[model samples]
Target chain A: MARVVVDVMPKPEILDPQGKAVLGALPRLGFSGVTDVRQGKRFELEIEGELTDDVVEQVRQMAETLLSNPVIEDFEVHVEEHSVAEVAASEGR
Target chain B: MARVVVDVMPKPEILDPQGKAVLGALPRLGFSGVTDVRQGKRFELEIEGELTDDVVEQVRQMAETLLSNPVIEDFEVHVEEHSVAEVAASEGR
Candidate 1:
């Protein structure tokens, strides 16, 4: 099966209270130096077969139509690794 | 200045109703071939200085204590490119 990851975030002009909340809480928690924060959404989609450009385009359409709100957000599709387990085990990112 | 990205996702064993809702709606929209879906959080952190290992560690702590709920989620620290503007411009992911 193929796995595609979609990352969605607010547009540059939008205000993200959730992110702001986190930013405000950072210094209080003893974590400083973070100047700003923008919170977003991550979607991991599992496909039944090989990943192709067609699948990417279809997923892009999904992002445009549903995964993100075009009026305020932006999204990007990434061919994710096998799973988060593997990602945590390797790359460590 | 530096930018770091923190991605938080529900644990594999956890129930993701939001993801399920999206999955259920996918086929109705005629976008098939997607077998499963998992929704997560992505945080873009803009820092005030150069990217150092210590900075990465600090952000990891932020992900643990603020950006994510460690009990039910897993988070990763990634050195993000300058900005989402750049991601949207190049790589396209």
Candidate 2:
């Protein structure tokens, strides 16, 4: 099965409290040098077939309509035939 | 500032309703070829200095303690000196 990955992030203009909270908590936890943080979402779709344009377009529509809020977020889609686990294993080689 | 990216995903054994909802909605929206979906989170940290090992380790700790739940999710950290926008622009070249 092909793996299609969708990455969604709040628009740069939007305030991200979760990210700010993490950033604020970092120094308190003894981790320093972090100046900013932005939180986002990622979706992994396992498809039964090839990584075709039709499939990619379909996934894009999904992102626009359901996976993300277009007014406040922007997203990107990545298509791969290998699962992320397999990709990580190969990278370890 | 350097950009640190943390990618967090649900354990393979866990259920992902958001992803399932999207997967289910695809065919209803006239999009096909998708079989499954898994959703996750991504964090982008802007650091004030270099992408050193110390910073990477701190970010990893943050991921373990705050960005994700170790019980149900796994996370990966990526350190880049260039911001994502810069990287995307360069890739557009």
Candidate 3:
């Protein structure tokens, strides 16, 4: 199976209140030197086939259509061919 | 600068309606082997100065407070150095 990871983020110019709130909270959490924080979204998909150009395209389209907000957000899609368990196992080694 | 990446995911027991919707739409987008899609969130922060344990802990707390829904989500945090521009340039090579 192919695994796909999608990351979506607000445009840099846009104000991200959530991110700002996190930034504001960092000092109280015991982090003194922290200056900024930005928040975004991630999606992981397991597809039942080999990783191919067509599959990548479809995944990208999927991100554009339903995974991201075109107005204020930007997105990126990454595809790989391994299950999460397999990935964890390989990393454990 | 230290770069912090936070990935937040729904607890396996929680229902991800948006993720389900994305999974349902994948087939129409032309990905055939796609079986499941789990959507989550990613937060990238550019912190000023060196990366230290305290900084990492602070970033994690920030994630918990503002970036994720505590009841339904689980999270992981990663810290690195280098600006986004530098990271992009290194990847371009």
Candidate 4:
């Protein structure tokens, strides 16, 4: 199956409390140099066939209508050659 | 400031109810061809300087220790040349 990725991130003006919490917690955990943080969502979709343009368009529409909130967020979509597990394994994790 | 991206995904064996909910909701929204769906997280970190190896290493460590639950999730890190807003603008959105 082909894998498609959709990333939904809050608008630049939107406040991300989750990311803020991480930013605050990081310095306490001995990590530094991170000036800001924004948390978002990622979706991986497994499809039955090749990544045809028609299929990609369908996914994009899905992302626009259901996967993201246009008023407060934006999303990007692309196809991946491997699944998340495959990528992790290839890195020798 | 340079940006770093961390993508944290649940282990393949773990049950992802969020993704399952999306999968069920898709067909109802008139989108199809998706056989499966997995939901994950994306974090964007804005740093003060260039993306040096030392800084990248720090972000990776942060991902491991705080951004994700190691027992249930796996994360990948990389440097992004632009923030999500820039990318969207370039796409003429």
**Which numbered prediction scores highest in lDDT against the true structure?**
4
Q: Candidate 1, residues B18-84: lDDT per residue as tens digits? A: 9999999999888999999999998999999788899898888888788888778888888866565
Steric clash pairs (candidate 2) = none
As a whole number from 0 to 100, the lDDT of residue B91 in candidate 3 is: 44
- Model 4 DockQ reads 0.80
TM-score of each: 0.92, 0.85, 0.76, 0.95
Best by TM-score: 4
Error of 1 at A30 (Å): 0.6
Instruction: Write down the C-alpha DockQ for each prediction.
Output: 0.62, 0.51, 0.43, 0.80
- lDDT per residue for candidate 1 within A1-93, as digits (tens), equals 988998999988899999999889888899889999999999999999888899999999999898998778878888866565466657553
Lowest lDDT block of 10, candidate 2 chain B: B84-93
State residue A60's C-alpha deviation in candidate 4, in Å.
Answer: 0.6
Which lDDT value does model 1 have at A64? 85
Model 1 clashing residue pairs (backbone): none
Query: Which digits, one per residue and each the tens of the lDDT, describe model 3 over residues A13-73?
Result: 7898988887787666655666677777888887776788888887777777778876777
Q: In what order do the candidates fall by DockQ, top score first? A: 4, 1, 2, 3
Superposed on the true chain A, the predicted chain A of model 3 yields a TM-score of 0.83
Candidates arranged by lDDT, highest first: 4, 1, 2, 3
User: Which ten residues in a row are the worst by lDDT in model 4 chain B?
Assistant: B80-89
Clashes of each: 0, 0, 1, 0
Instruction: Flag the better candidate by lDDT, 1 or 4.
Output: 4
Error of 1 at A20 (Å): 0.8
